[model samples]
Target: MKNITPLQVAILVALATAMLVAGSAHALALAQSRVIMLSLITGISVLAMVYYAINYFIYRKIKLIYKTIRSTKTLGGGEEVYSMNEDPIGQVYDEVQQWSKEQTSKKEEADQLEKYRKEFLGNVSHELKTPIFNIQGYIHTLLDGAMEDPETNLNFLKKAARSADRMEALVKDLLTISELESGSVKMDWENFDLQELLQDVFDSVDHKARQRGIQIQVKAGCRAPFMVRADRKKIRQVLVNLLSNSIHYGNDHGLTQVGVYDMDRHFLIEISDNGLGIEAEHLPRLFERFYRVDKGRSRSEGGTGLGLAIVKHMLEVHGHTIHVRSSAGVGSTFGFTLDKANG
Candidate 1:
C-alpha cells in the first residue's frame, strides 16, 4: 500500500475508533452504553487536536521555506506571487535544477570566449613581432658596417622602410576591423554598376597581376552592366581584396575570373581563380583574421592577413553572406550576393 499523508492518517484513525464504539455498543449492557459514548467523544476530540496541531507545525515550516525561496528571487513590489505547486519542497527542487542548467550554459559560453581571447592576442603579437624584428635586423646591419658601403646602405634602408610599411598596414587593418565590429563604420549606400566596379578593381591590381604573369578575366556572361545597391567604397575594397588574393595565389600564367549572375532581387557575384586552391578544412576559417592556408606564402606576398576578414565583415554589415568552394589542386571560387537595384 502507498504511504498515507498525515491528514489521511488522522481521518482513518478517527473513523476506526467510531466503528469500534458502534460495534461494541451492540454487545454491551445498558450501563456500558454511556461509557462507550464517552469513549467515542474523547477519541474524536483527541483526533481533532492531532489534525490541527500537525498542520499548524508543518505549515509553519513550509511557509518559512517558501519565504526563503522568494527572497532569493528578490522580486520587486509586495504583491503576492503564486507557488509553482502545492508541495513547496518539490517546487524548490525543480527551481534548483533549472538554476543549475542555466549556470552550466553560462560557464560554457565563458570558456569559449576565453579561448578566443587568448588566440586573438597570440595572433596579434606574432604579426606585429615579425615586422618589428625585421626592421631591427636591417637597422643593426646598417649600423654595424653596411652604412659605409653605398650599395648595401640604400638597400638596407629600403628593407627597413618596407618592414615599417607592413607594420603600418597591420595597425590600420586592426583599426578597420575594430570599427566594423563595433558598428562605428558608416556605410555610404548607392546604386552603382557592379560590373564597372569589378573592372576598376581589376585595373587597380592589373600591375601586380602582370608582374606575376597571371591573366585576369571577366566572364562573358557577366561583362554587361550589373547594377547593385551597396556601399560603393566598401564594396570596392571587397573586390580588391578578393581579386588580389586570387592573383597572389594563382599559378604562373593562370587565370582569375569574375562572374555575376542575375538572381531575383539580388546579384550573385563570384570570383574564381585557377590558383593554389585551399583545402576543405581551411575554407571554414578562411575569413578569420590572420588565418592562412600557407602562412609563409601569404606573409611573403605582402598582405596584412586581414583582407578576407575585412571582406566578410563588410558584406555582413550589408546583410549579405559570402561563400567559397574549392578543391586542393583544382581551383577556388568565392561568391557573395548584392541587392539588385530596382532601376
Candidate 2:
C-alpha cells in the first residue's frame, strides 16, 4: 500500500462525512415516509468510516517503513537497515547498500595507490643520493692527495674532475625533467628549418659517429626550409640524447637514419638505429624516470637514466607525443611530432 500523508487522510475523512450528512438531510425531507432510506444512509456512513480507518492504519505502516529506509542511522548504533521485505522502502535500501559497497572499494584502491607513490619517491631519493655521495668522496680524495704526492695528486684531480662532470650532468638532467614535468619550462615557438636542425645535430655528433664507424643518413620530404613551432633548445637536447643513445648502443658497422615528414598540421622526425634493440617487456616502461634495462651497462656508459624521461616530458609540453618501435635483435626507431607553423 502506498503511504498517504496526514493531511491527505484528513481530507478524505472530511469528504466522507459531508456525503453522509447530505444523504441524511434528504432522508429527513421525506420524513416517516422514508424511514428505510434513513436507516440505509446511517449504515453506509458507518461502513465508510470503517474503510477509512483500515486504510489509515495501512498508510501509517507504509510511512514508517519509508522513514526507516531513508534514515542514515542504523536501528542499533552500527547496523544499517538494508531492506524490509516490502515496497518502495526496500528498493531504496538496496540502492544505499550498493553505493556503500562501491565507496568502500574505491577507498581501498586509493590507499593502495598512495602507498605505491611513497615507495617510488623513496627509491628515487636513494638513487640520487648514491651518485652525489660518490662525487663528494672523489673531490675529498683529490684535495687530500695534493700535500702527500705530486703524481698521485694529478691523477686524483683528473678522477675528481670526471666525477664532478658526471654529477653536473645528472643534476642538469634532473632539473630538465622536473621542469618538464611541472610544466614550467616554456618553449620559444617560432618558424625554423627542420633540415638545418638535423644538420646541426648530425654535425654535433659527427666525431663520435666517425670514431664508432657509424654512418648517418638524412632524408627529408619537406623543402629545405620546413618550418615548425617548437623550442629549438629543448628539441636540440632531445635530438642529442636520442642520437647519442643510438651511437652508444649501435652494432659494429651500423647505420643511423634521420628522417622528417612534414604533414599539413605537424612535423614528424624519426631517429632510427641498427643497434642492440630493447627487449619487449621493457618497452612500455621506457619513459619512466631512472628506469634502465641494463643498469650495469648504463652506469658504465655514464647514463643518468633520465634521458628518455626528459624527452617524453619535453615533447608532451610541446603538445606532441613520442613513440618507439623496436625488435630485440633488429633495430629501434624513436619518433616525435612538432606543431607546424601557422603561416
Candidate 3:
C-alpha cells in the first residue's frame, strides 16, 4: 500500500476489464472461443495504454520533481542515489521536507553568525576610535598655540604618544589573533620547568603590579620545578596576560596567586586573583575579542582586549582548553592544562 506502482495500477485495471468483457459476451450467448478472444484482447490493450500513458506523462513529471529537489546535492555523493522500486511521488515529498528542514537550520546559524560579526566589528571600531581621536586632538593642539607653551607642549606630546602606543598595541594584538585563527602561527614546543617560567612572568609583570602594590605569589610547594611540555614562549605570554589582567582589576594592595597541579596526564596551571571578578552573564563571553567589563579600565590601562581571546586560541591549538570561575565582587581563577613532560 505504501509503495503502489504504476504497473500495479495497470494490472488491476486490466483484470477488471477482462472480467467485464467476458460477462458481456456470455450474456448475449456468444461462442465460448469468441468470448475468450474478446476478453484477452481488451485486457492486453487496456494494460498497454495505461502503462504507456502513465510513464510518458505522470511518471516523467514525478522524476523531474525528485531530480530538482536533489540536484543541489547530487554531485556530493550518497550511498543510494537512485532507488528503482520506491514510489516516486512519496520520495519527492520526503526529500522536500528534509531539504526544507536543512535550509531552515542553515539560515538560523548564518543569521546568528552575522549578528556576532556585526557586534564584533562595532566593538573594534569603538575601541580604535577613542585612541585615534585622542591622538588627533593632541597633535592638533600642539601644532596650534600649545606649541609656544613649553609646559603644555610636552604634556600634549606625551598624551599623543600614549594614544599612538595604544593604537599600536591594538593592531599588534589583532594581527596575532588573526594569525592564530588562520593556523599560520606555529607552536615551538619544548620541555621546560613550568615553575621557572612562572617566576619569569612574575618578574616581567612586577613593574606593573608594583603600581598598585599587588603581591604576585606562587602557591606553597608549587614553586618547585614541575616540568611541562609546551610552547614555552606562548605559555609565558598566557601567564603574563592573566597576571596582568589580575593587576588591572585587582584591589589596591591585593594578591595574585599562580598554582600548578598534577592531573595525571597533564598539569593544570591556574592564575587566581583577589580582584573584582566578572559577572555570571559576562563569563561566557569574557574570552571574546574586544569584550570588556564595565568596571575595568582594561583599554586605558594598556590592555588590547584581545588578551584572553589570544590565550584561548593558543591553548586550543595545543589540544587544551581554558576554564574560568568568577562572580561579581569575588575573586576569579583562570586555569588551563598542559602535557606533563615525560620522565
Candidate 4:
C-alpha cells in the first residue's frame, strides 16, 4: 500500500467512502429493526476506518522510500544502490547499478581509444615533416645556384634522394603495419633453417656494414641445419630491420653481433650492438611507431623509426616475444624467442 501510486491511493479512498455511504443507507432502510441493524452499521464503519488507516500508513512508508532513492546521499556517494532487503525494489536497484557500471566502462574505453588516435596522428605528422622538409630545402637550394655549382648540386641532389627514399620506406612500413594490425597479412609458415634465414639477412646488409666500417658477425650455438617453423619472408624482414638499425646507429668501427641459441622450449636469437644505446625512458617505447630518441640523428641516419615497430608486429604474428636491454651510453641488446622445433 505504501508503494501504491497517486491514482491507486485515490481509488482506495473513493472505494472506502462509497462503502461508508452504502453502510449508512442500509442502516436507514432497516430502521424498523432497531438494535441489530445499528450494531451492524457501526461494525461496518469501524472496519472501513481500519482499512483506510492501514492504507495511509503504507502510503507514507512508500513515500519515504521514494524520497530516499531520489536523494544524492542514498548509497553514501557510491554509484551502486545499497539496500538491506531482497525485495522487488532492491532487485530493480541492482539492475540499474549493473547498467551504470557497463556504461562507465564503455565511456573509459572510448576515451582511451580517442587518446590513442590523437597520439598516432601526431606521430605520423612528425615523421612525414622530417623527410618532406629536407626534400623541399634541398630542391630549392639546387634550383637557386646549386645546379651551376657541380659539387654542391650533386651533394644536394644526393641528400634529397636519400630523404625521398626514407619517405618511401616509411610509407611502405606503415602499410605493412596496417595490414598486420588489421589481420589482413597472411603468413606462410613452414619449417626452415633459422641459421640459413639469418645468413641471408647478413648477406643482404653486409655491403652496407662494410661501407660503414662496422663488423657484422653471426654465431650459431645451434647446428647449421637447425630448423623452426615460421613465416620466412616476414621473419626475414624482422631480422633485416633490426640489423639495419644496428648498423645505422653503431659507431663507425663498432661491432654488431648476432647469436642463435636453442633454449629447449624455445629458440632464442639475440642481436646486439655497441651503438648509441637508447635511454631508459626511450627503451620501453622503442617499438612504438615513429618514436625517435634523437630526431636529428635518426633523420641523418635515414631511419624512419618504424623498423622496430614492424619487427614487433611480425614477431607477434608468429606467437613470439621480443625484449630489449640497453644503457644510455653503453650499448643495446635485442633478443626474441621462437617456438622450439617440433620433435
Question: Which residue pairs in candidate 4 have backbone atoms (N, alpha carbon, C) closer than 3 angstroms, thus clashing?
Answer: 2-58
User: 2 or 3: which has the higher TM-score?
Assistant: 3
* Candidate ranking (lDDT, best to worst): 3, 1, 4, 2
Give all candidates' CA lDDT scores.
Answer: 0.84, 0.76, 0.86, 0.78
Q: List the residue pairs that clash in candidate 3.
A: none
Candidate 1 per-residue lDDT, tens place, 44-160, comes to: 876787677756776566667656655655334563343422443455567656656766888899999999889999999989998999999999999999999999999999999
Per-residue lDDT of candidate 3, residues 1-343 (tens digit): 6678778888889989999999999999999999999999999999999888877798777777767766764335653343324566666677778888888888899999999889888978987998999999998888878999999999999989988988898888888889998998888989999988888888999998999999999999786789899998888888888999999989899999988998999999889998998889999889988777863577557776789999999899889999999978989999999999887
- Model 3 misplaced stretches (Cα beyond 4 Å): 1-3, 19-29, 78-85, 300-302
Best by TM-score: 3
In candidate 4, residue 185 scores what lDDT? 82
Better of 1 and 3 by lDDT: 3
lDDT of 2 by residue, 1-343 (tens): 2654444444566556656665777656766536555555655665566556744675456557656654643333443332222343445557567657866888899999898678667756866676678767766776776637878777766776777788778878877877776777777877787778878998999998999899887854543676878888888888999998898878868899988887679878899999989998999999988888889888888886888988898888888889999988898999998888777
Off by over 4 Å in 1: 1-85
Error of 3 at 8 (Å): 3.0
Q: Please give the lDDT score for candidate 3.
A: 0.86
| TM-score (C-alpha) between model 1 and the true structure | 0.81
Error of 1 at 1 (Å): 9.3
Candidate 3 positional error at 241, Å = 0.9
Task: Identify the runs in model 2 with alpha carbons over 4 angstroms from their true place.
Answer: 1-116, 140-147, 220-223
Q: How close is candidate 2 to the true structure, as a TM-score?
A: 0.69
